[model samples]
Target: MNRLYHVALSPFCRKVRLTLAEKKIEVELVEERYWDPSPDFLRRNPAGKVPVLRMDSRLMAESQAICEYLDETLPNPALIPADPEARYEVRRLCFWFDDKFNAEVTRPIMNERVWKKIRKEGYPDSRAVKSGLAAVKFHLDYMGWLLDQRRWLAGDVMTLADFAAAAHLSCLDYISDVDWNRSANVRDWYAKIKSRPAFRSLLADQLPGLPPSPQYALLDF
Candidate 1:
């Protein structure tokens, strides 16, 4: 059986999970404490990431690579676009979420609000959380602007870019950090994506002592 080593709230892991579910690939979910990696885990991924995937005889490390490989191997519901220009847009948006949005918002917020508590490292830093909250508004507005022109973030068809953006936002949503009312376009987009069959596993995830927000699992929210 295919297996995924992941933390419940990691956007990188969630991106891979979304891609796998979209492809209808069955995978065993294993929650890994990557901050304190074991020897075996380190051997699996020297980078010490949460989303180390073991499929058949292959072990995949990077989230984007794993997702792209899955899309390539299972082409029925293609997540990456075929056209080069369309593909470039998808990749661009994927990086915008995973790299830019993550750095500005997701990491700071999750680190302060979630990981610190989980790891017993320190108290939640209010200033960092506030900064993340402030930064997220800009991102939401940006997404709203994009949605104004296109059906999806990358194009008319749903793609990895949507999943990438959703992955990060979903994590924040779990913590009730996302103000869905801030952008009608983003809220409507999220509602549509959140209702997908591929999103069920993520909606069902429960972290010890850190339950999801009331609306996190609500399809109508």
Candidate 2:
């Protein structure tokens, strides 16, 4: 069986998990604390990231790379377009969510509200939490704009871009950091994504002290 070493709430791990599930790839999920890295885990991934996938005869690191490799290796249900231009758009949107959105919103809020508590680093920083809250509204509005123009972030087809966006949003939603009311379109889009079978494990995740929002596992929510 394939295996994935992951952190439950980490968006990068979530993205890889979603991709594997979408491809009908059955994997044993092993929760890993990447911050307090083990020597064996470091042997698998020098970067000490939570998402390290072991498949068939090889081990893969980096969420985007792993997803793309799966796309290329298992082409039955394609997540990336064949055309170069279309593929570029998908990659662009994936980066927008994973890099830009993460740096702007998810990391800040998760660090302040969740990671600090987990790491025993210090108390939550109200200023950082406030900034993350403020930034998320802008992101939701931007998502609304994209949804207004295209069925998905890149185009009509659901791609890695959607998974990438959902990964970050789901983490925020777990913490009740996201304001779904900010954009009805974005909310509806999220609901559609959340309803997928591939999202089940993610919705069922329970962090030790940081419980998910009440609506986290509600299918109708």
Candidate 3:
């Protein structure tokens, strides 16, 4: 069986989990303390990232690489498009969320609201949290604009881009950090993604002392 070492609320980990679930791949989930990486974990991934996938006797790191490899090998429900231009669009949007969105919003907000509490480090920085909160409005508006033009984030069909965006947003939603009221388009798009069978595991995730927001698992919301 395939195995995945991950943290429950890491968007990068969630992205890989989403890809695996979307392709009907069953994987054993192992929670890893990435901040305190064990020697064995480091052996698996020198980078010490949470999402290290062990599949078919192979160890894979990097969510984007693993996801695209799966898309190439599985080929049933294609997450990346066939046309080169469309594929570029999908990859572009995936990076937009994973890189830009992460740096601007997820890292700052999660570092304050979630990680600080989890690590028992200290109180959250209001300025950093406020900055993250302030940044999300622009991201939401960008998503809304994309949704207005296309059925999904990349095109008419759902792609890894959508999963990438959802992965980040879902993590934020777990802590009630996302203002779903900001964009009807984004909210509706998330609702569609959230209701998928692939999303069940994410909705069911329990963060031990840190419980999810009340609406995190609610499909109607």
Candidate 4:
């Protein structure tokens, strides 16, 4: 059986999970405490990331690479575009969310509010959380602006770009950090994505001692 070692709220793990679900791949989920990596886990992925996918005698590291490989092997529901230009746009947006937005918002917020508590490292830093919150508004506005111009983040079709963006936003949404009211377009986009059949598992995820927000599982939300 295929298996995924992941943290419930990590956007990188969620991105791979979404891609796997969308491709109708059955995977046993294992919650990995990445900070306290075991020797076996290290053998699976020397980089020690949460989203280590073990499938068909192959162990895959890197979320983007795993998602792309899945998309390539299961072409029925293509997540990456076939056209080079379109593919470039998808890759660009994927990086925008995973790199820039993660650096500016998701990583900082999750580090302060979630990881610190989980690791028992220290108290949540108010300044870091505040900065993340402030930065997220700009990212949301950018998403809203893109949605105003196109049906999806990369283009008219739903692609990995959408999944990448959704993965990050869903984590924030789980913590009730996203200001959905700030952008109607962005809110609507999220609502549509959140209602997908593939997203059900994500919505159902229950972290120990950290329940999702009320709106996290609400389709109308």
Off by over 4 Å in 1: none
Q: Mind sharing the TM-score for model 1?
A: 0.99
Scored by lDDT, the top model is: 3
Q: How well does model 3 score by local distance difference test?
A: 0.95
Instruction: Count the clashes in each prediction.
Output: 0, 0, 0, 0
Better candidate number, 2 or 3, judged by lDDT: 3
Q: List where candidate 4 sits over 4 angstroms from the true fold.
A: none
Error of 1 at 180 (Å): 0.7
Error of 2 at 100 (Å): 0.7
Per-residue accuracy of model 1 over 1-221 as CA lDDT, tens digit each: 99999998999999999999998999999998888889989999989887999999788999999988998999879999899999999999999999999999999999999999989998998999999999999999999999999989998999999999999999999999999999899999999999999999999999999999999999888
Error of 4 at 7 (Å): 0.6
Q: Model 3 TM-score? A: 0.99
Q: What's model 4's TM-score?
A: 0.98
Worst 10 residues of 2 by lDDT: 175-184
C-alpha RMSD (angstroms) for model 4: 0.7
Give all candidates' CA lDDT scores.
0.94, 0.91, 0.95, 0.93
Candidate 3, superposed: residue stretches over 4 Å from native: none
Q: Candidate 4 lDDT, tens digit per residue, 64-103?
A: 9998888988987999989999999999999999999999
Report RMSD for candidate 2. Answer: 0.9
Residue pairs with backbone overlap in model 4: none
